[model samples]
Target: METNRNSNIIKLKQNLKYRNILIDAFPLLGLIIIILFFTIITSGNLLTLNNLKIILNQMFLYLIGGLGSVYLYAQGGIDVSMASNIGFSAILGVRIMYQHVGIGIIATLLIGSSIGLLMGIIYAYAGIPVFIQGLAMDFLLKGTLYPLSGFKASIPVPDRLLKFDNKYFAWIFLLIIFIFIFFTYNFSRFGKECRSIGAGEIASIQSGIKVKKNKVLAFFISGLTCGIVAVYTLIRTGSASQSTGLGFNFNVMLSLVLGGCVLGGGNGVKVRNAVIGAVTFVVLQNGLVLCGASARAQDIVKGILFVLMIVFTSKMYERKV
Candidate 1:
């Protein structure tokens, strides 16, 4: 009886190991299937060089913003205002460019970081929930920018900035940011602290993780990335409008989820997830267009996929827990 019981336990462990492997592979599999399906439907137009370039261009901002958001999300924090903050930062940057291009870029980054730091402090020290704080900040920034831009439907970006739109520059910048984030997130104490906090705040605090300080730092890092991405947006569009960054936060959240980064945080977070998710997202959007799908149809498809992905990932995490 003892021997039989031991064998059954071993069989159960083997089954669990296989289950975990499948969960890990699902995102990549989904990406592959999407690409293949779209390629066939589009008559292979999806993989043409021009379309590929367009996809890459669309992906740059999402990839960077998504990376920044990873820090906040890893600690189970949400910032609904990130898109608005980017819009405000771009407006400020464009205004400064009227004086000096170099100064404009520097000023934009500084403003973004400062605002992010302030929000972090409020959430961490003032006992405000990050979600509520983010919502307030979003409204405040969007309102401030709306009036300052003369309520213009679109703020024009300077023509001089258009020279910087080369894909090579974007690739290099993205690579650097990815490498820096990858090392910091995987190798540093900061990353470990973030994971611990996300896993269990009470447990992390009892373990001497300095929860408040880390939370503030995570927001700061997220803000800094936002600052950089603001620059990317300015160059890409050469302008900022009232609707400039509208819906960006949702897109980033969707990308993170599609990449397998759990909203509950801990253990499953990875920089690669941001990269893969960004690519998949851009491809999905572009492919839908190439396949002649209507705007409403595209949105409906994306929405359904987003919810299903969330449900699937949530189950995977629950099983692991």
Candidate 2:
């Protein structure tokens, strides 16, 4: 009887180990497996350097938006108007960049950060909820820019200012920033407080976490990222149009979920998850384009993936009685 019980325990341990492997591989493992299958089907044309570069370029803003939302989502708060903030700031920044490089860029970012900071202050201090604030921001920004740009107002983005989209330099610069954020989140006091607040805001406040202040700081950080991405956006397009940021609202949300972040607080909210999810999204799109998928079709596919990812990653908790 003793020998039989020991045998059963050993078998259970082996099965648990196998399950852990499967769980860890679930993220991107599907993406890799699909890529391998398609590579064989496409005769290895899917793995070219050109395709990879295209995918990386597409991933730029996805990663940016993902990392920016990390602190917000982790803290049980989110701002969907980030794209609008970008759009609103793009008009201000790109317009400034038309002449002076040094002063224009600085002024644009300061203005961009200020725009987002306004939303944060309303939500954090004025006792206004984030959802309403974000909605108001979206409407306010869209309405404000729609008439101002005058539809097809072709504003020139200078070559000197366009160096960020230089492919090589952008990669290096973003990588350095990613590394810095990773380390900060991994080994900083802010990271701990964020987790505490995420776990329970009331408890964190009771524990002296300064919940409101940190929440505002998170938005401010997100605004800083918005400023950086605004510069990149102008560079990539080389010309700003009225419709520059009309419908990017969903893209920001998609980037967050794709990064394995849950809507409510207290879940997987890592910078790496968002980066990987963005990469996967970009690569999948690049591959589809290579296979002659139309841009319209790609939009439909993106919507499908967004739904599927949300469903698969859904979380439910129950209390034991």
Candidate 3:
């Protein structure tokens, strides 16, 4: 009887080991499947050099946004105001660029970080939920856009700023930001603290973690990235409008989830998730257009995929817990 019981326990352990391996490999596997499906549907047009370049270029904003949001997501928080903040920042920054390019850049970044810090302050002190604060902030920012744009439909960025709108600059900037986030998210005390909070806020507090400070800092990081992405978006498009950055926050969430981030957040949250997710998202979007999928159809597909990912990740999280 004792021998039989031991064997059963051993078998269960082996099964769990295999399950964990499968979970870890799911994101890469999903990415492969997406690529293959799209390629087939587009009759290989999705893999063309020009199409690939467009996808890569479009991916930068999502990648940066994902990287920044990873910090907030790590603590089971999110900033839905990111899109609005980017638009608002771009408007102010573009106006300033007309006067002084360097100062304009500085001002844009400050605006982004300041908004994030303000959210953190409200969350930390006033005890407002992150989602609630983010929505409130989003509306506030959007409402001010018209006034900022002088009631115009769009505002062009200064011509001098267009020089930064190339593949080379994007690649270089992405690499720098990726390295910074990689180090801080994977190796630093702050990363550990954030994950711990996500894992269990009560436990984190008891363990001497400064939960509030870390939470605020994470929001600041997110906001700062919004500023950087704002500038990139402005330079690439050469203009800012009320429609700028619309649905971006949702896309970031989708990318992160697609990359294998559990909405609950915890030790399982990997930095590479953002990179993988960003690539997957861009490819998916580009491929749909190449396949002649209608805009409405694309939205339906995306909505379905997003829901499926959320459900799957949530189940996986429950199993781990």
- Tens digit per residue, CA lDDT, model 1, 1-321: 999999999999999998888888788888898999999999999999999888988998889988887778888997888888888888887889888888988988988888888888898999888888999999899888877676787777778877777889789988998888888888899988888888899999999999899888888877777688788888877788777778888888889888877898777777777887898899999999899999999999999989888898888878962
Please provide, for model 2 over 1-321, each residue's C-alpha lDDT reduced to its tens digit, 9 standing for 90 to 100. Answer: 999999999998898777655543455675685578557756677787776667678888878767766777778777767677777677777767766777677876786678768777887799788888888887887787765555556676777886655778888887887887787666787866776677798889888888878788777777777777677777888766656655555666666666555566653566766776787766666676777778998789778877876765553111100
Give lDDT: candidate 2, residue 13: 86
Clashing pairs in 2: none
* lDDT score for residue 37 of model 1: 96
Off by over 4 Å in 2: 1-24, 147-152, 293-301, 316-321
- lDDT, candidate 3, residue 204? 95
lDDT score, candidate 1:
0.85
| Tens digit of per-residue lDDT, candidate 3, span 145-252 | 999998999999989899877788679878998999999998999998999999999999999999999988999998898899888888889998887888889889
Model 1 RMSD in Å is 1.8
lDDT of each: 0.85, 0.71, 0.88
Model 3, global lDDT: 0.88
Question: In candidate 1, which residue ranges exceed 4 Å CA deviation?
Answer: 1-12
What is the TM-score of candidate 2?
Answer: 0.85
